[model samples]
Target: MDMDGGWCSLEEIGPLSKLRRLTLHGLEDVSASSLAETARISSKEHLEYLELHWSSSGCMELRDEIEKQQQQEVVEEVLEKLCPPPRIHELHIKGYFGRTLPNWMMVVEACACKSLSILCLAYLPCCTKLADGLCRLPSLERLVIADAPAIKSIGSEFQASSSSSTVDGGVTESTSAAFPNLKYLSLVGLCEWEDWEWEEQTVDVTAGAMAMHALERLEIMKGKLSCLPPGLANNKRHALRELNLVELSNLTSVENFPSIVELIVCDCPKLKRISGLSRLHKIGIGRCPSVEVLQGVPSLHSIELEDGTIERLPGYLPCVNPKFLKLTCSKELHGSIISGSSSEWEKISHITKVVIYDIEDSDEG
Candidate 1:
């Protein structure tokens, strides 16, 4: 049920014990105390999903109070009282800017929701330790974090915490395990991140190797990633099947992906070449100014190229037996196609379903 910008009394939700899903969006007037009171009385023991969207206006009104340490403690205590027992499998929080995780977000006890699988946090301004707590969720399979500009690093603190123990001779066999079941991860719109640097506290190659062994898909969109994380590179032999790099302006090269079946590179203007994609079957390359070659993939069946700098097809085209080939190049290249002398045009006949349209026509019609 939709409850947006409305006063939902704690006493009103107690009768809806059979409700399976609830959304409290843009809760402008709901205070932490009232929310906690509702949680204490709500009989929705079967609730499987909950979404909370904090109001920007509400946060502004309590900004000063929330900043005080005592106020923060009060807020956490209220949240703990309000949090439903771990019966909610999917939890999504948006616009939650608290400096630390809400007390209800502790993974060890909150993950008791046997069906919990997906957790999404969006537009959270102060979630430095959220990732660490999230990794402890035993059944978590998919996680999406968007617009969290303040999250400077992930998997870094845990690595650091472990290292401190080793240096102090406190390391134990139990310390090596973390996030063993996570399979899909997506990060987007983290504008301040320059790179995924491997600091001393970052996960070691071996740990990364173990993580990659279980990971099957990764999408990094709109970040400043200059290179692949070293752990993924070192463990290239893992089971990853799909890789997507979108609008990452600083990325210039791609490391090998021998098992990947799909690779999409879009809006990476500086990307000039792609290498070591031998198992790729589908490729989409668009808006790249420097790309000139399609090399190292013998099994490609679908190919797309648009807005590139190369005047002719790269030397590797003849080797690809693509079933669906699409190419859109400069208007100048169109004249060569009409005149029938472009060497690039010669290679099109080899592709089974070749479709070439000038950039202008492709855009207008």
Candidate 2:
């Protein structure tokens, strides 16, 4: 309960009824029957977690688009009277200027909440989509869509819907999976998120392999993503195991991610290719210079190259040798890795720990 605009009058608190966490920010002077009694105190079934914020400085003084669609219909009528609490598990809707949302946030069994796992839809500018029943929530594990810059697309209605089963007494129809137990997925600072297709015949094929079957750690930063979500492209990820792509400059491609095992690609400069990640053990490539090549990672032990634009390396290794090789790069690639070249010390000679620094001694250490 954090309304800064006009303190008090969510029907004056009263029956918190064992409230279990709630945050309502500077609601630009709430009132629509006190936001419908704060949506009936969030339909308390012992509320689980709900955050609703408004007033991005009173929506930057609504620079007229008919007064910002009349303050986006009064912030979608106070987020449809601030409803959400059918056992809400976690829901955060920040700085809303609602373009749409209501209808119990797109029917999670009509806002039963199904114990929602975590859903954060941040700084909505004019919410283009998302929150339209958010893939029908089946215990969403973790989802973060930040700083919405007028979403570009996450189409296919974000899947998850078909339900009906009874077999043996006859009924059968079960097929729905979208964020089906999602596991840590973050998309930050969406600068007009490019696309996230998903609509391959409205799921089937066992609901498209139960959709991202329990995804395991995936992060995309500063987005404008050019690709991703063909079930995480190439070989369709099974249980993504840690993958990070930063500064997505209209990402080009990183091909397969067959159960990735720790991989980071930063400052994607029109990413070219990183080949089929064959269970990488740990690899970090920064300021990518259109990644020329890095054969099929064979459970690579460890490698962290930043800058210098990878002069050379990655011929085979990964038969369990390398334990760590962090190259900061350039003083002529640290003098071609120590001795100008001897096949770069036979290509990092079975590395058990090689940290070639310098790039101004790694920024003056």
Candidate 3:
């Protein structure tokens, strides 16, 4: 039912105990009682997916600071009462303007939604950072955080606190294991995010705690992430296979993907070096002018470059033996590559297939 002005109350949905999925929109007018009654319904246990969104119109034209603050408080209260029942496998919260999330989204033990696997949080413009408990969920496999402009860091709060029972050989009892079961993660459009702090106690993979042990693919876009999470980058046994970094301005180097098979770097102007990717098979670089070398990547078979400045090939090119090579360069660079006198010609001559395009052609075509 649409949550527009007084159309349906939570009391009406109380008997739908078997609900498997639900989307509630136009939450601006929903009262705190309506939301509380909705959460109290028995159907919460059967809900597998839930999406909550507030109306854009309700928050768009407000110019009064006091009135806006009052509205924010009401929104927060309504959201607090709208908590989804435990065991939900998927949840999406969008356009929430509250400075903090409700307890249901962050309290791990109390909510006990151990079956929760996929969580997507978007357009949360006021939340400074993710809820600490979100990273400690036992079954969370996919997490997406997007468009949170105030978030500046992801720190120890993202990890499970150390437990009291001491284990053998100097390991902590609880061992702050964060995202232990996560396989896919994406951080997008967090314009203010700058730091992803590494909690050494939780991230030290060699200490026998498997942190982010199940991650396979990671995508970061439109953020200030200068480097990867140290726990993820340093873990040699991590299962990551695909890594994509797009529009990260401060990132200078790409390193330590020991088993990654696919790598994509785009629009990172400060990027310079890529090393220690031993199992990579495909590589794509675009709009990164400072990147100069790619080494220790012997398994690379496909390479694509767009608007890059490197004139020579990798020092280990004889071992790379790429099956496909594509380059889109400036007119001068394109001329130099095709010229028999340029060293770039000899380096890529052995490739079985090569595709070339000038910068203008690439853009126009």
Candidate with top lDDT is: 3
TM-score of each: 0.77, 0.37, 0.87
How well is each residue in 13-124 modelled by candidate 3, as lDDT tens digits?
6667788887777677765545555645324788888888876446646888787777777788878777667768998988988878877666667346678899999998
Tens digit of lDDT per residue, candidate 2, span 70-178? 6677777877777776788998988877777676776556346778889888878777887646656778789988888888777665654435457785856655656
As for lDDT, the candidate ahead, 1 or 3, is 3
* Cand. 2 TM to true fold: 0.37
* Candidate 3, lDDT over the whole model: 0.76
> Model 3 segments beyond 4 Å from truth?
1-7, 31-43, 161-164, 167-171, 200-208, 308-321, 350-352
lDDT of 1: 0.65
Q: How many clashes show up per model?
A: 0, 1, 2
Superposed Cα deviation of residue 142, candidate 1 (Å)? 1.9
The model with the greatest TM-score is 3
Task: Report how far residue 282 has shifted in candidate 1, in Å.
Answer: 0.8
Better of 1 and 2 by lDDT: 2
Angstrom error of the Cα, residue 175, model 3: value is 5.3
RMSD of 3: 3.4
TM-score of model number 3 = 0.87
Task: Return the number of clashes found in candidate 2.
Answer: 1
